[model samples]
Target: MEFRGLGFVPLFIALWCTAWVVVSYTLTVIYGHAPLLMYISQTGNYYPENITFKIGFLGMSNATLVLMLLQYNFILLHAEAFGARQPMIQRILLAMGITSCIGTAVMSVFETDFYPVTHRVGAFCAFACGCVYNLWQAILLYEVPGIRRAICHIRMVSSAMAFIGVITFIGCRVSVYTKLCTEDYEKIIEIISISTEWLMLLLILIQLVTCFQPMQHLSLTVSRKGYTICKRENQDSAV
Candidate 1:
């Protein structure tokens, strides 16, 4: 069995998820229940697991995971074909990405209201490791010469922006914990933190969006009950 032209799968999934999340959060706010400045996963915490959690949150998390999986699959092949020396780093990044994805789904299932402790732990894993995933990929991209033409400056720039966002988020939490922030100050920090988080994710997805230029011909052929990158000749093969 073979799957050709599957490159856009991740890109489409990213776009769909991003739009859905914004729309879901917008609806939640518009309904006069959710507050003005909402966290990305805030809507998911609504009691009874509203449609936002079921479709928007779950759908976005899983879809992003699938997209990352696909992107990393391409990265592995791209590295192998290009002769990247550090296989260990790429493997670690891939593993961290996969783990974060699983954590995202798990966190979604156990909302913050229902299971605060467990959800916080899972969120930490998801976002913390998620940062590593993006940063590491950017590292590899910079170190590897073969993908320079395919991966433009946007990848590097976006990765840096995402890292800045993480730093801002952590800084906000630290300020609050140290009693350095007043109630109003904390609220302002939270809003900035939320915006940064969203921007980081949006940029990450945008990086994937541009990936179509180079890997749009990525072949996903089933082999030995797994998938392998097939050559152009196998483009039209069926199961």
Candidate 2:
């Protein structure tokens, strides 16, 4: 499947997560230098400034792993929505999960450029994903006539999470630009980072909420199957 359009979902998630890591590292390095790092200089001290860069890059790598996990769940959710029946979806999701995990492991071993410009590819990918998912949900709501009635709850939740993603992207970009304004622009960046982090976190929480409800429904359905199987077994024994 050409993820040309769906590519952004993973991309943006990476960007938001990376930004969180970088900003946090920046705060830590600056704070470590002096109580006044927050007041005077945005880049902190010069000699050991590379430490923040290393720390931020490490944070980015960790966040990417978390993003990959979510992507696995997303692929499963995609397969389920497309009607893979139980067994097929399970196998497909497992394969995709394993592949993504392995790919991430390979990437983790390398040390490469961590500049924002280089990282913007991830940001662009994230924007693309967010937009595509929004469109997909809209299509699901309007075009897919079969499950419209049944999926009202799903649509509502998906719409809310998608909206948050859009808002988070805009907020993060603005904060990044603001950080470039002056020497001591770090404080404002820190504030903005905290806000965006919470926003992205809210998205994570929403995903968790969606994940559990479906599993709950699936468990109930499986229990019904178990009951039927047991009943048939007892009847055969009686016969």
Candidate 3:
């Protein structure tokens, strides 16, 4: 009857997907500024040159920040649930998830056209750290008795897909830079890279859905200390 933490899972996914769709549609259909096969970063580039750039930039940056907060909360929940079994592993997972989230935010904030080096670095951090985090989480879930076996298996498959997607994305991009392929081949590779990037994003979102069931019973609480500046001390404390 109570789905406390489950709402955030869908909310995060919806916001992310909505942002991508709105920005992509505006750029490709409304403005004709980019083709359908453009990479995710391309949608947000050329700030101040087009109104769509502002839409893409703000949408992605805010969405990624929301994702960052969601991931941080999820890591805290996992640590609370499973920290007793593998404290060090929990710490590592928390670090990796947060790093990936921050990387995503960085990439979203720094458009590829304006900040090429910084954007590439951010993309590398996001994908690489995110891949490790997903795989590690799958392994961690496997060792837990309370979690469903189906969820563990689903995470394993999704994580594997994400790994392949990352490899394909990076390989395609590298091939483009090498200039070893013909122009036609370069175009094909670029399309593949863009498709793989989207696929990887979907896989990551699916992985997040797995947390819903496990976190259904969990609820977040906020409290203020009696000694805080905004509040008076409790009568019991004075006594």
lDDT, candidate 2, 36-77, per-residue tens? 323212232333544444444445445444444443343344
Q: Which stretches of candidate 3 lie over 4 Å from their true place?
A: 1-3, 6-10, 47-85, 226-239
Candidate 3 collision pairs: none
Stretch of 10 with least lDDT, candidate 2: 227-236
What's each prediction's TM-score? 0.80, 0.36, 0.75
Least accurate 10 contiguous residues by lDDT in model 1: 230-239
Q: Over all chains combined, what TM-score does candidate 1 have?
A: 0.80
Minimum summed lDDT over a 10-residue window in model 3 is located at: 226-235
What tens-digit string does per-residue lDDT give for candidate 3 at 196-224? Answer: 98788778777767765544434444445
lDDT of every model, 2 decimals: 0.68, 0.41, 0.65
List ranges where model 1 is wrong by over 4 Å.
Answer: 47-49, 80-85, 142-151, 223-226, 231-239
Q: Show model 2 residue runs off by greater than 4 Å.
A: 1-113, 127-158, 161-168, 171-194, 216-239
Number of backbone collisions per candidate, in order? Answer: 0, 5, 0
Error of 1 at 172 (Å): 0.7
Give the C-alpha miss distance for residue 158 in model 1, angstroms: 0.9
TM-score, ranked from best to worst: 1, 3, 2
On a 0 to 100 scale, what is the lDDT of residue 173 in model 2?
Answer: 58
